[model samples]
Target chain A: ELKVEQNPLFLSMQEGKNYTIYCNYSTTSDRLYWYRQDPGKSLESLFVLLSNGAVKQEGRLMASLDTKARLSTLHITAAVHDLSATYFCAVVYAGNMLTFGGGTRLMVKP
Target chain B: NAGVTQTPKFRILKIGQSMTLQCTQDMNHNYMYWYRQDPGMGLKLIYYSVGAGITDKGEVPNGYNVSRSTTEDFPLRLELAAPSQTSVYFCASSPQGLTETQYFGPGTRLLVL
Candidate 1:
């Protein structure tokens, strides 16, 4: 069974601050995905890190994957109130099946 | 393109009652998936389908069933509703491969009493 763990399950940060959410997996997988879900909404894809050393960024969020270490990180740079949401990291295994982390709920205070 | 769509934005069901959650995709995706999100938890995959007439179970697939009769429609059926099944259900679709991004529906909030 593939297990994924995320740190700081609940984070309250002031606007303009920076933080990083770590996602650690138990198995070896090359594909990791980052997704964001607002309250009462479905998930929105943030980034897809396909290989080791793969990094992708959009706006204030950036995600990186290190396959050898079975880890992925989602970094928030200069956070804003609009960026407040629940973020999740999922590791793909068993032929397209995904195992997701518990998730990080971020609350940005203005 | 409307992307992925699910019916019944919200529903309340008593124990032992059954219901079917409808999902459709307009992008002609080959892969569709059903996931459930509980309070303060990540989404867990219940089932998935790679294409029409092909269905498979995922991480959590005990109380639910799914069918993909057509390329654009994948509906999830709950046999006997229970309080444990109360959660928000999301349907998602991907074009072809694992590397492709999955587009998610708005989600259906189901409350089983």
Candidate 2:
């Protein structure tokens, strides 16, 4: 069974602060993805890290993948209230299927 | 373009009942998937289809079933629903591309009491 673990399941940070969410998986796959979900909403794709040391960023969110260590990180820079949502890191399981982490619920206070 | 659409935004049923969630996409995607989302748990893949008439199971595919008879339509069927089956279901599709990023539907909230 492939397990995906994420750190700091619940994060409460003030606006303008920075934080990084860690995702570690137990597998040999190289593909990783990040997704965001607001309350009662579907997932919104954030980033797709394709290879070792692959990094992608958008706005204040940046994601990186380390295939050698089977880990990935989602870094939030100078967060804002609009960035408050649950974030999940998923790794490619058998072939093209995805196995997701538990999720990091971020609450940014203004 | 109605990228991805799911019908019956919400439904509630008792145990032992059955329901089928409808999902369709207009982006000419060749791959489609069915997933379930619990409260704090992230999306869990239930079933996926590589193309028309081809289907496969995922991490969690015990209680649910799926069919892909057409390129644009993939429907998930829940038989003898159990309380554990209550959750928000999402359908996604991906076109053959570099990363194959999936486009998701709004979602269907199901409650099995």
Candidate 3:
């Protein structure tokens, strides 16, 4: 079975702090995706990393993937209260099915 | 355009009742999926379709049934609603396969009493 694990399941950071959320998978897969979900809301796609060392950034959020290590990370820089939400990292196997991590809940206080 | 649409944004069902959650996409995506979101667990795939007439089970398919008779529609059926089945259901679609970025619906919130 393909399993995805995420560390620091709960994070509480003050505004303007920097943090990194780690995701590790047990299998080999090249495709990884990051999504953000606010309380009571559906998921919003954050980034899609397609290759080893592939990195994508938007605003204060950036995501990177290392397929050989079967790991991915979502880095939040200079966070704000609006950035508080649950983040999920998912890996897509060769069959193209996604297995998601447990998710990391982030809270940024002002 | 409506990227992906799900019906009955919110519903409350009594135990043993049945209901179908409707999903449709206008992006002409060939791959569609049904996922259930619990409290802290991310999305758990219940069923997926590669294209019209092809359907497959996902990680959590025991309590759900799905049909994709057309390219634009994939509806999930719940035979007997239970408290364990109460969660937010999301419908997602990608252009080709699992490697593609999935566009999601607003989601349908269902609660079993």
Candidate 4:
């Protein structure tokens, strides 16, 4: 059983600020993914970090993985209202199966 | 390509009731998965299928069943509904390669009373 822990489960930040959400896993797997979900909506894939030093950025969001430490991160830059959603990090368990972390609810206020 | 689609966007059922949640994807993905998301919690994998006629249980599978009969469709059956099963259900699919970038369906909100 893989245990995944995320910090600061609820984040309230102002627009134009920056913050990072951390995901720590209990296993040795290089496949880590980030996803975002709006209220009452399905999840949308953000980034897939496949290597220890892999970093991917889209729009104002960036995700990185440090497989050696079993950790991954999702960073928000210049936060906007549209980024107010729950973000989750998941690691592949086996053969395309994934185990997800407790999401971080982000609220960006102007 | 419609990506992934699920039927019955919302449903309310009583205890011991049964229903089958339908999922289909036009991407012709080889791997399809079923997940349930409770309020304020991460999505938990209920079941997954690698290909037609192949299926496996995931992290949480009790009281849920799934089948894959074609490359595009995977249906999950709930035989005995319980309050614990009340949650939003999502269906996702991914290619067989290494990336495993999953595309998700809108979701089905089920409430067991």
Candidate 5:
């Protein structure tokens, strides 16, 4: 069974702070994806990491993948209240299906 | 394009009732999937189709059935609803490769009585 785990399931940070959300999978996979979901809303695609050491950035957020370690991280820089949301990482297998992590809920306070 | 669209944003069903959750994507994606999300658990794949006329089971497939009769539509069927089946259902579509990004719908919230 393929399992994806995210660390610091609940995060509370203040504005201008920096934090990283970690996602580790139990299997080897070359594809990883990050998504954000606000309360009662659909998921919004954040980043897609296709290879080892692949890094993608969007606004104040950056995501990196380490395929060798089967790990992915979403780094938040100078976070703001508007950036508060639940972030998820998914591991993709050869079958072209995604197994999602439990998700990290970030609460950024002013 | 509407990306991925799911109908009946919300619904309440009585036990043993049957209903279908409709999903369609205009991106011409060849892969469609259905997932269920609980309160704190991650999304679990229920069913998926590689293309039209090809459907397969996923991690959690019991009590659920899916059919992909066309490239753009994939509908999930709940034969007999139950309390445990009440969750947010999301339909997603992606292109045919493993590197493709899956586009998700707004999701359907179902509550079983």
Candidate 6:
């Protein structure tokens, strides 16, 4: 079974601060995905890291994958109130199945 | 494109009652998936379909069933709803598979009493 774990399940940061959410997986998988979900809303894809050392960024969020370590990180730079949301990391295994982390809920205070 | 859509934004069902969650995609995706998100937890895959007439179980398949009769429609059926089944259900579709980004629906909030 593939297990995915994320750190700092709940984070409260002031606006303009920076933070990184770590996602660790138990199995070897090269494909990692980051998604964000607002309160009472469906998830939205943030980034897809397909290989080791793969990094993708959008706006204030960036995600990186290290396949060898079975780890992925989602970094939030200069956070804003609008960036407050629960973020999740998922590892792709067994061809088409995704195992997701518990998720990191971020609350940005203005 | 309307992307992926799910019906019944919210529903409340008593124990043992069954219901079907309807999902549709307009992007003509080959892969569709059903996932359930429990309170304060990540999503657990219930079922998935690679294409019309091809379906498979996912990580959490118990008490849930799915059918993909057409390329654009994937419906998830809950048999004998239980309190443990109360969660938000999301439907997603992807052009290819996990290698590609999956578009998600708004999700259906189901509460089993």
Candidate 1 colliding pairs:
none
- DockQ ranking, high to low: 6, 1, 3, 4, 5, 2
Alpha-carbon DockQ of candidate 1 = 0.82
Q: Where does candidate 2 stray beyond 4 Å? A: none
Among these predictions, the greatest lDDT belongs to 6
In CAPRI terms, model 3 is classed as medium
The C-alpha stretches of model 5 lying farther than 4 A from their native spots are none
* TM-score versus the correct structure, for each prediction: 0.97, 0.97, 0.96, 0.97, 0.96, 0.98
DockQ each candidate and list the results. 0.82, 0.68, 0.74, 0.73, 0.71, 0.91
Give lDDT tens digits, candidate 1, residues B39-70: 89888999999999999999999999999999
lDDT of 2 by residue, B26-74 (tens): 9999999999999889999999998999999988999889999999999
Question: Where does model 2 sit among the CAPRI classes?
Answer: medium
- Model 2 chain B: lowest-lDDT 10 consecutive positions: B95-104
Tens-place lDDT digits, model 3, residues A1-47 = 89999988999999999999999999889989999999888888899
Please give the lDDT score at residue A44 for candidate 3: 88
Residues A6-86, candidate 4: write the lDDT tens digits.
Answer: 877999999999999999999889888899999888899999888889999999999999999999989899999999999
Query: What RMSD does model 6 have?
Result: 0.8
* Candidate 5, chain A: TM-score against the reference: 0.98
Better of 5 and 6 by DockQ: 6
Q: Model 1, range A50-90, lDDT digits (tens) per residue?
A: 88999999999999999999889999999999999999999
Look at candidate 3 and tell me the lDDT of residue B93: 95
State which candidate, 3 or 4, has the greater DockQ: 3
| Overall local distance difference test of candidate 1 | 0.93
Give the alpha-carbon lDDT of every model.
Answer: 0.93, 0.92, 0.92, 0.91, 0.92, 0.95
Q: Tens digit of lDDT per residue, candidate 2, span A1-110?
A: 88999999999999999999999999898888899999989888888888998989899998999999998999999999999999999889677699999999999999
User: Which CAPRI level is candidate 4?
Assistant: medium
User: Could you give the interface RMSD of each candidate, to one decimal?
Assistant: 0.8, 1.9, 1.2, 1.6, 1.4, 0.4
| Candidate with more favorable, higher TM-score: 2 or 5 | 2
